[model samples]
Structures are given as C-alpha cells and as structure tokens.
Target: MTTPLKLTEEYIFAHDLREASAKIYRASTKALLKHFRTTPIEEIDHRAVLAWRKKILENGLSKRSWNTYSNHLRTVWGYAIEHGLMTHTTINPFRKTSVVPPKRASKTINGEAIQRARNWLTSLVGQERCTQERTQITPAWFWLAVFEMFYYTGIRLNALLCLRYKDIDWDNKMILVRGETEKTHREFFLPIMEGLAPHLCRILGEAEKIGFSPDDQLFNVNRFSRHYHGKEMNIDQVESIYRKLTDKIGVRMTPHRFRHTLATDLMKQPERNIHLTKSLLNHSNIATTMNYIEVDYDHMRAVLHERSLAQGALSRVRRVDSSGTPPTSAITAPSAQIRLPSRKIADPKPTTLQPPQQQAAIEEVIIDRPSRSSGPSALRKALEFASAQLHSGSMESATDSPSDQIDQNLLLTLMASGLGVGTFRKRTQSERSMGSTSFSRASP
Candidate 1:
C-alpha cells in the first residue's frame, strides 16, 4: 500500500544526498505526484507512466527534460524494490522509457564579447566607493574576482558556490573540490593558475579582513546584499548579476558558457591535449568534455593552407633535353626552373651506333614513356623539345654520355606524371637494340 510520494521521501532520506541533488530529486518527484497523487505504487503500471510522459510532452517539455525526470523516477523505483517497499514481481514502468534527444550544436560566446565584459569588470574594480557605502570594498571588486575565477578555472556554478576558505591550499597552489558539490560526486583538486592567483589572493585578503572562518563560504554575499548578508549566495542571485552584465555588454553571459569557452580555447591550442582539458574541467568522461568543445574553422584553415602543393618542395618544374641546348624554333622557354641539388651517377661505357639507328632509338624512347592526362605545361614543353630534336636532325651529332641520356628520359617521365624516378629501372643494351630495330622498320 506504499505510494510513490512516500517511497520518494524515504529514498531521499536513506541516500542522504547533497542539497542541490536533493532539490532536483524533490522537483522530479513533484512532477510525478501531480499525476499519481494517492495512487498505490503496485497499481501504477506502464500505461499510466506512458500517459504521464505524453502529458509532459503536451505541456511543451522537451525530450531531454522528459528523460531527466524519468531517470530520477526510475532510480527511486529501483531503490524501493531493493528496500522491499515494492513486490519483487512488480515491474518498474519508468525503466527503459527515455528517448534519445536530438543533438543541437552549442554556440560558444564570442571572444570579443568576453573581452568587453572583462574590461567593464576591470573598470568597476578600479573605481572608488562613495561615503554612503557601509563597507570600504565595493561590490564590483567581489564580482570581478568571481568573473576571473569563472574565466580562468572554468569551475561549475554549483561547485563554485559551495567552495569554502579551508579548501584552498596556498602553499600547494591547489583548490580541493568537495564530492558533495561535484555533479559526479567525486572529490578532486584543481591547480591555481598564475593568472588567477592574484585575484584569489585579493579576495582571500578581503575575506580575512571581514573575519570569515575557515568553514565559512569563500565568497561573502554580505559585501553586496543586505538581505543575503550573512547567508551564502544562491544561483538565482548570481544569474541576476550576469543578466545585468549581458544587457550592458550586448551579449548573453552565463556561468556554463564560461566552461564551454575555456574548453574550446584549450582545444584550439597547438598541443590540443583533450585528456588534459578533461582533467582541468573535472569531467567524469572524456566524451562529456568533447561535447563542450566547438570546432575552430579558422585555425583548421591555417593548418591546411601550410600544406598546399603550390608552396611545397616540388613546386619548381625543370625540363630535361638530351641535346644540352635549348630548342630555338619548335620549343618555347619554360616559365621558370629552380636549380636543385643533383646526385652523381657512374658513367656508362660508350656504345657505337649508326646515325639512323641512334635517331630511331631516341624517338622510340620518347614515344614509349607513359602518357600523362593531367601533365603540367612544363611536360608539354618537354614533348615539344623531343619533336624538335627529331626534325632538326640533332641526334646524329649528339655525343652525350649514356648516363646523361638515361637521366634525360627519367626526368621526362617524372615531369609527366609527378612521380619519383627511383622506381624506373634503366633499359639494358639488348632492350635498347630491340627498340632501335623496331623504330627503324616503323619509320616512314
């Protein structure tokens, strides 16, 4: 005869959750209580739970919100079954009822907007207070410290609010995060960075002057608010301050956006250590940290630009001709030729040959080279030089060394296909003689 409301109250009491977690749990169960008030836990079946889910969507609640509420209820039901509040045969209707929410890209705050807000806060920090103020320190200085801590450390709003004076270790330069304040309920430590140390020290000095004990909240609300003077500042009051600043800066500002911005900026660094960023942000899983980062297209473009082919080592094009002289009538000058270091090759033995046979052999070698469909203009010029050499009858008078002739053919192949010549094996004497005979018969 136990009801969901009674079970939820018992579950909350048994678990001893933190204030924030307990508040969320109460709110989640409140939604269920609206639909199933006074209904027995054994009588509420899957159909009733489905009807409640439909009503939530009808009320304009998002799938993400529906999932969150269902998760809390499901956990409560599981706890009831474990504690013998519910029958072992009874089914948990809330289990496996969540739908995957559609993913939306998270927009990061613009760097210029953040800079403007920081500048505004800095100006406020420097201003002198009027005589009417009760405290010597202005509220702006306290808010400035909070703003810098959010920017530099990227701590969550809840954890930041829960921070105490004793958590800071000045000698170790670290701040201990309590498990109760963390979303994952795990204790961890964060380093006090160089840029953030000064602001923290200033705030600590002010807190000491006010005689705050080690267990008291680090950020004193008393400096600014008369109502919350002795009490710790809550989320709504902090959000109200950000909303006012958003209006002044013409850009929306929130505590979570600071976490997103810091995560993205760290990812854009040259090292781009994602694991390090996860550790800094105190994320339970690396995947959760990944969702916080936004792609920096400009930085990606700069990296890709540096790898372009036009600016690479192979950009300079050279033409190789066996005649060792530039063609005058048939071939035009190349656009440019950059001198590159050449490797030495052993000279080959001289081979005697008839003039006609030599001319036909050179022609066959030129025609046998692979065709390039997308060859550069330099490759076209090389083919033109070969035609000029054949028509000008310069092959008979050529006395180039065998190594020079082989290098000429290798270079022509390289220019045509943009491939390295190392893989192209040299033709043997028998292969050259065969090519000469084949070209001699085919000549018109």
Candidate 2:
C-alpha cells in the first residue's frame, strides 16, 4: 500500500545517514517526484526513466552528478522491491545508462600554510587579551578550541560541529563520534591528543559557565559571532566562520586539508607506519590513506645527504709510512677527523737493524696506535686500502718478516690481486727450500 514517496522516507530513516547525506538523497529523489508525480508504481517504465535522464543530460549536469542522482533512485527502488512495495519484474532504467564519474585528483595541504595559520591563531589570542571585553573570554576560547581540535583530531567539520558535551569522556580522555553523525554511519572514538587536550578544557570551562547539559552542543555559534550573534548555527554559517578565520591568515585551507596534512606527517615518521596512519584516519581501506601521503622533499634530502657522507668517508685510501713501518696517526687521519684507526698494520717483527729514521717512524706509529675498540673504523680503512692496492698492482714486501707479521689489509690486497694466502705460503716455502737469496732481500 506504500507509495514511492513514503518508501523514500522509510528508506532514508532506516539507513540513518547523516543530515548532510540525507539532504542529498532527498534532493535527488525530489527530481524523480517532479517527473512522475501521478505515475503508479507498476506503470513506471524504462521509457519514462530514459526521458528523465535525457532532460538531466541536456541541463548540463556532470557525469558525477548523473551517477549520484541515479544511484540514489536505484537504492530507493531496490529498497521498495525488497519490502514488496514494488514488483521486481521491471528492470531498473537508471542502471542501463552509461554515465561514468571522473577520477578525482589527489589533494594535499602545505605544511608551511598550516604553520602560518597557527601563527595567526596565536596572534588572535594575544589580541583578545588586550581587548576591553576580557570578561567574555568564552568566544575567544571557543574559536581557539575549534581551530586546535580541527587540526589535531582530523574529524570532519560537520561531525565536529555535531559533538555534544556528553560525547566527551573527560574521565577516560576520549571523544566518541556517534554513528548518527559519522559519514560512515559507524561509531568510533578518538584519543584525546596532547596538543588538543588544553583547548578542550578551555571550551569545557566556557560551556560550564552557562550550565551546559550533557546534550548541549560543544560549540556555541552565537558566542563566535561578532555581528549576528545567535544561539545556533547551520552548515553554511559554520563554513563561513572557518573561511573568515583562514582569510585573516591569507591562507586558503579547509578542515579536510588539516586531515590530509596530519595524515601525511604521521606517515613520514621514522618507522613509516602506514597501517597506524590508516587507523588514525579511520579509513576503511588502506588505499584511501595512502592517497593522502604526498612526497616530502625535506626527508628525502636528509637521507641522500647521509648516504653521500658515508660514501665520502669509506672511499678514501689510507696513507703508508715513508719508513716502511706502521703509519703514524698524524699522517693518515680519519676522514671524519675522528681519532679512529684507519688501517690494520701488521704485527711488528723482533728488532734486528735500526736506521735512525725507520726507528723514529716505528716509535711514533706504536705510540699513536688506536685501541681495539676502533674495529669498525679499522675495517673500513682496510677495505679502502685493499681496493687501492688492487688498482695500483702492489705486492707484499719480501723483506725479513714472520708469517704473522703480514698486515690484514695487505692480505686482502693480495687476495684481490688473485693470490690467495695458501698460494703465497706455498711460494714462500718453495723459495726457502731452494735456498733463494731473494727471500730476505728488499724489493728493487
């Protein structure tokens, strides 16, 4: 017995969509009622829908608009069929249309713009203190609270305006967004963040001054007004207030921009926890959260700078002592100017002959030797020195020396030059067996 108009009312009520969403559905359905005012449910056909759609297209409506309006009608029709208000025998004419919505461009807010907005807010607070109407601090406190809450919570503007004093659990330190007010129509709670807590308290104190009940709206629009001061505010009025606030700072921004900026900042943390950012933004799909993160040049530059510094320090060749002993720390200083070992010198052989210059160089090398704790720096230097020796085609000195007296860097250098330790040992042993005089002689 229910008509299409009555069925539309029932469907909207059952869904419990937010006021803004309900308004859109109603507007879309209003177009349908105007076109088929007297048509019976069973008599409405595909031809009638096509004529209505053609008129909408001729009126210069966008594909997104066509899709939205068509979707609204289709949902209502489906609801009617499910409840037996209309027969399912007839095909849905709206679905047969070929309209497609265009892809939306990703939007992001500038960090510098946010900072400028904050500065403007701070200056406004200072100006309020200097005013003669210091007794009425509620208005100033209310706007401050609104501005901070929007920046910190990332909640939708309408959801925030709909918040009541009861929604805040001061004891538990959380704000609950009721399912009725939420865009998703699902209830969720946000933790009271550190920066946002003080502003909440300020507004709470202001509300208490008027004996605010649990059901009273958190933000009083009348208090915020400079001219048309009143008890309540509509969506248009709330947006107007926000526009004026941002205009003062000369930055064009909206409540949703704060959400994007916060999401991007959270994703840029050291951990880069995108899952945590998704939960914070209350996004049902992770892809939606990913869309909010824009490229940050500042963080990228820091990483590249650190990489360059590492390469510069690790790519240098370590210096060798002129006297053929371990190099003095003064001659082969670490690239970072840090007093860490830059190369591994061989264990010295027992003293035999001591030329004055060689003996002085050896003494200085021993006195300036780095501690065992400098292993990492020593390893880096060894790699660098070994690489240099490979390119220069250098060989280990064949002068008087024990097996253990060979430098680790020299061993690595020999290996890089295609001579393993085993091969070098075999060659040395063969020379000894043949009584070769070259075994103890210095290289020419």
lDDT by residue (tens digit), candidate 2, 1-444: 656678778888888676678788888777778878877766667777778788878988787787788888788877777776666454665566547667664445676777776666666677777873533233555566777887887888778878898999988999998877767667888889888899888778877887789998887756444654667655676577568766766666677877887888887888889888777677777888887887788899988989877777543455444657554343223321211123332334332222332222211111122343545556456556644533332233446332223333355443343321221221233224333221111111
Candidate maximizing TM-score: 1
TM-score result, candidate 2: 0.59
Model 2 alpha-carbon drift over 4 Å, by segment: 1-4, 34-55, 88-90, 96-98, 133-138, 221-229, 270-275, 284-444
Collision pairs in model 2: none
Please give the lDDT score for candidate 2.
0.63
State every prediction's TM-score relative to the real structure. Answer: 0.66, 0.59
Candidate 1, overall lDDT? 0.71
Native-structure RMSD, model 2: 12.4
For residue 338, what is the lDDT in candidate 1? Answer: 18
- Stretches off by above 4 angstroms in model 1 are 88-90, 105-107, 129-138, 224-230, 297-444
lDDT for position 195 in model 1: 84
User: Deviation in angstroms for 358 in model 1?
Assistant: 19
